[model samples]
Target: GAIVWVHASQPVQLGSGEALEQRYDRRPGGPRIHSFQVDGGPNRLIEALDKLPGVIAVPRLGTVEEDLAALVRRLTSGDPAPAVVRVRQGAGGAERSSEDRTAPHLARLWALQQTQELRAKRQVRDAVELAGRFQLVTPVSGAVVLENQQQYDAAGLTPVDPQTVPSIPEPGTWALLLLGGAMLWFGRRRRPR
Candidate 1:
């Protein structure tokens, strides 16, 4: 028999309508089956997963390592997790008051959930550190530094100032100035000795 590795971060719940079973695999690389007669909501599942070491329980959409770390810190400090859990009993008839009281319980459960999340984050950080030590990758284009006058001169590249306003000559401005200078020079040269 071929052994297949499953790398999912969630536990699969089995059964249908009114009869549900929550399964947890505690043994390393082993199959597991669990059946219980209790309300197994997300909070309950998260609480259970938190008890298992190396088990990281993330939401369906997933969360970042930083956020998970912060959650862990808060949970370790006896602070409540910042997650809201809503439990509803029945479809449209009288709602059960017991379900309404589960909110505070959910908050407590979140703290436990964060413990597993934190462990997973630590594992990821350790793995990253280990991998970085084994390989050193450098930029192919090399370092980029601010181009100073010395650097530009060395590289033979001309740098222009874009803020400079070019001085424009008036219509026949240069010609008029040159003509005036010539008249003055001729008058001076032709002066009686």
Candidate 2:
């Protein structure tokens, strides 16, 4: 519904884990903080998180850092918290062989799980609303009603007349027309010149 702000980290080579403490805002306005010792690849993690509702383009900090920083700073001065990604590089960081291999996979799985959870939650919400309350037209729902002119005028809507409404001829009507045409042709052929 609104512009999405994404903050990402510089490219860090894999195998650098167990020595770094990555701390950042889960979301600018989010309630909790995230601290991780493993490098889940900030760019990759952000990419995975992009499936969430209202998320837009995933910005690459290394390439568009200055431009994005300027635009964001000018547009929003922390009015609504942007997604802040905090990644701290530590000394002797490239050590944990196992974490390095698993972090990316874990991060991707986390993103997919979050996406599915959100979708499921949305479906539940829609089902509850549709089942319990009066229905209204929405992007995700629709209805049809054949209203009279008076009813259409009351609702401030235009009603289509039955004559203008599209419909197919009945099978009997088609058969009768075909037989009439064939009889006419036969009569014309049999007539004397």
Candidate 3:
């Protein structure tokens, strides 16, 4: 049997902040229509994310860690208001928006994904390191054998000599033994009894 530990987070206040989500709709021959769905109230940051001029205008951190940290800070900011935002795309590509803002739910989801990614990388690194230390066979670790005695000598490594061991007799040998035993039994029966 094994023990397990589980932790549950506090429930998010449903009416406190607006739930923000983006949707893209494409009809059979219609232009792609992009829209945002807000639950509670209008959010300035959400608007800014949507109408920001170009990709350069949208704000971003240098690294995923930095982005996650920023999201954490926002969630802990203590303002109990719902916000909505959209990402604006420009002709060239996804244009930058004025602010580097993200929906809390979206940010939370992204952070969770990033955490999993980091964990997987760490596990792989640890596994590789362990395999290297113990000389264990893994995807990135393998064994190489010297081709012959000369190769072993050149590398200053002694090769274990092959050992001689007894093995089972062939089928013909078994047949010959059975034949001899039958003949001996028959001869004894005729001469003595």
lDDT of 1 by residue, 1-193 (tens): 1111222332444423122112222233333221221222443343444444423343322344454455446545866435554434555766656354444334334433443344334454543333333221111112224468898788765554433323468769999999999999999999999
Global lDDT of each candidate? 0.41, 0.45, 0.41
Task: lDDT winner between 1 and 2, please give it.
Answer: 2
Candidate 2 total steric clashes: 0
What is candidate 2's lDDT per residue for 1-193, written digit by digit as tens?
A: 1354444453544553222212111233322212121222555443443334333443344445564565457445645446544332334864445334434334444434443343435564554344222223332334558457787778776654555333678899999999999999999999999
What is the Cα root-mean-square deviation between model 3 and the actual structure?
A: 29.1
Superposing every Cα of model 1 onto the true structure, what RMSD results? 30.7
For candidate 2, which ten residues in a row score worst on lDDT? 17-26
Write down the TM-score for model 2.
Answer: 0.21
| Best model per lDDT | 2
> Estimated TM-score per prediction?
0.18, 0.21, 0.16
Q: Given candidate 1, what's the lDDT at residue 146?
A: 43
Cα displacement (angstroms), candidate 2, residue 10, comes to 9.2
Residue 183, candidate 1: Cα error in Å is 95
